[model samples]
Target: MNKVKENSVFFVSLLLTLIFIFWGVFFTENLTKVTNAVYNGSIDYLGWVYLGTTLFFVFFSIYLLFSRYGNIRLGRRNDKPDFSTASWLAMLFGAGMGVGIVYWSVAEPVTHFTTPPYGEGYTVEAANTAMKFTFFHWGLHPWAIYTVIGLALAFFQYNKRLPAAISSAFHPILGDKIHGPIGKTIDILSIFATVFGIATSLGLGAMQVTAGMHDIFDMPNTLFVQLLVILVATILFLISINTGLERGIKFLSNAAIICSVAIMLLVLMVGPALTVIKVFFNTTGLYLSDFLQMSLRFTPFGEGEQWIASWTLFYWAWWIAWAPFVGMFIARVSRGRTIKEFVIGVLIVPTLGTCLWMSVFGGTALDLVQGDHSLAKLITQDESLSIFIFFDHLPLSTLLSILGFAVVAIYYITVADTATFVLGMLSEGGTLNPSNKIKMTWGVIQSALAAVLLLAGGLDVLQTASIAAALPFAIIMLVMSYSLLTGLKNETVMQKGNKRNTQQN
Candidate 1:
């Protein structure tokens, strides 16, 4: 009974996840119907909330960079950073994005070009718009979502000596209540969001890996192949989780970054090198000029509304759903960094890296698709094959495809590895070092959820699950910002009081 009471959050979250997996696996059609209903309703009614709240986080993150607390360290003043700067950037970038970026880099640009949000499709304007919006979707807004939540969690956990859980960030508002039902409820919500969000990525990774196999090795693109991909990646990530964060995840993250850069450079050298450079600069200008307009963009009474819902709103919700897992993972590794340093590292570095990636792969794809109706049609039929198809037009197609496979597979393992660690921390009452047993449990559950999502309805079902779980968590993140401010204000007051007392004595 005591053990159950102590680990009540774990037991409850596990039961909920198992129930969901059963529904997705057993009643696949009903699960699809219900999630699709929820997904559509969310877009129809609450789409504005997703846009507005994410924009607010962007502003809030910018505010913190220059706030009075900018110099405050995440841990004690004397504490030093655990990892080197390069390693830190690689790990956070790897955990925060990984499979999604690689999967989308070529696919999204080609997609937007063929079916843009506005104006005529398959025009030069459409190509320009495609790159601009890809930058927007993968840029500052998502990182802001990760930044504020991560900043709050790191502040409370390291500075205030609180547990390393989502609920702990609300101590200022919830007080002792954070330890009761309210706290457990918050953590449970986090678990659901993390599970589904990571599952979505896992499903995407499995699909893309399967696509690579089919394109390069002549393997059939079937459910069995996808499931096999997931199983193999699952075993690797589980091993990574057991090896702990410092060794397994760190090594893989660094390697993934190197491999990713290699692939990008190879594509740039072999395919439209000058066009990619021009596209990078041109799109950066457009992104800056139209950042605010696009940040709050919605088409309520117009032609592009459905497109916005399908693409922009979906991307926003996916990022929010991912916030807790990525945020906690980032905070875990960000001890001893000051607020200013944290923001630049977390927000600036990854956004620039992602935009550059989009420019390279997306630019090359755009250039290739010109006057090539069949290639465009092939991509339009299935986006998972976009990158592989793009490679077909390049020299040494076989080598490039193999390298791309390696990058995605590595990212797949790294993300699942990081996620299992974060899930373990959440389930074990925010312990920095959760036992291997707890980590293993979450690793298996997430892999199962990924497989079920794939089996149920493929990509559409995965997007719905992410958007459905993200709405509530977006609200939670907004509240967490206020709590963090309250905590910071109180800390300043206590410091001033102590200073006066010491002088008097």
Candidate 2:
């Protein structure tokens, strides 16, 4: 009877993943209608949700780093850094911020070039707002969400002898006696959410790559091209996941991020470096000044509602949606890490990457527009055209621009690859060592989802789907908060006893 039930659980998990894959590809158009409504409905408090999450994380991170809780070590039998700290941070950030940062480094700045929300009146160096907005999006708050879950997963998995699954965090509520079918159900939901959430990012990345390619090469955007890219992404991730994080995924992440850094340096030298720096700081200043007001504004009228729903709210929901997949990666890598090290690394280093990237892509677009009367307005005419206008002003023009487009293409693949690997882990009952077959299956699932979303209208569908997945997780996050708080309270006593034993001995 128990064996039969175990097999049944596996079948149900498999069924959910297959269903999501189908939804992502074939039914994504209809799926988008449902998802967009959820997106629209979330708008009323989505801004506050993001702001509150950000603030809680900032404060929580401070507590973790400075308090005794920071010293808490996790993992089996003994506590030490479970993974190399640098490798750990890289994987976590690469999985979490990889695609969004890549797409926005250019798209965001271009959006800001014409009518930056805060300082629409900043006449001279409007691109400054572009850089600042990048910081805001990739800053401390977003990382906080990942950090909270990472801490919870690591603590419970290690100290409590639980699997590193989201439901495992609820052990205090359900207890070990409630394992089996109940536990499997939670695991299934996590897997389903992780797969769809990641596919959403992969799909969006593919579309951005498509648009960027169209601008650079004048190639027609077609389903055939998108599918080819998706397949490549799946294969890359399958190889990486099979090889596991220590070998393949680590090398690939390091290489991809390094290549991106080199591209940014190239843009800095050729584009207006001084102007980019200045505007980046300028945007930062403006964002800080208006942070609270921007955080809470409902903006229920005109494009205000539309912008908030599509732009800011979309970012909020997307981050929330991605919370599970990315959050899980962070948790896995964070074993043996002091809370202080994990929190700071997760929050601060990634923000630097985000700021610089925005400076490169956004600043370049702004400079092209500001320097040339014709290109300035062209930047905003269509998001797809901004890259073309900016490249028009580059040193090698067409050649460098094509390479730039290729950079984005590869970046998307990297994003998809990481998403595929992570989703595999989720489906494998959050096992520390998941099977390669599971990884490959999830990879294929995400690829199919991306294809469906792209064919249905690109990122709009992806965004809608991702946000809807997150709404349920919002409730999950809340439940997690109480469970984590209870766990941390118990951990405090355990630490005191350990200290006492050492002193008495």
Q: Per-residue lDDT for 1-505 in model 2, tens only?
A: 8755644544676687667556656776677678667666666545566556656666676677787676666664377775676666667767767756655555566666566665563356455555655666667667777777777777787788887677788888778843676777776777666766766667666666766667666777766776776777677667766777677767766666666677778778887899878767776677678666666656555455655556666676677777777777777777777666777778767766676677667766766656565566665665544565566678867766666666666556566666666665555556787777766776776677667666655456665666766666766776776787788779889778988999999
Give candidate 1 regions above 4 Å deviation: 456-459, 497-505
List ranges where model 2 is wrong by over 4 Å: 1-4, 7-10, 20-30, 45-47, 76-79, 118-130, 177-182, 210-219, 300-303, 373-377, 381-389, 397-406, 456-459
* Candidate 1 global lDDT: 0.90
Residue 371 in candidate 2, Cα distance off native in Å = 3.7
- Model-by-model lDDT, in order? 0.90, 0.67
Residue 181 Cα positional deviation in candidate 1, in Å, after optimal superposition: 0.9
In terms of lDDT, the poorest run of 10 residues in model 1 is: 454-463
Distance (Å) between predicted and true CA of 58, model 1?
0.7
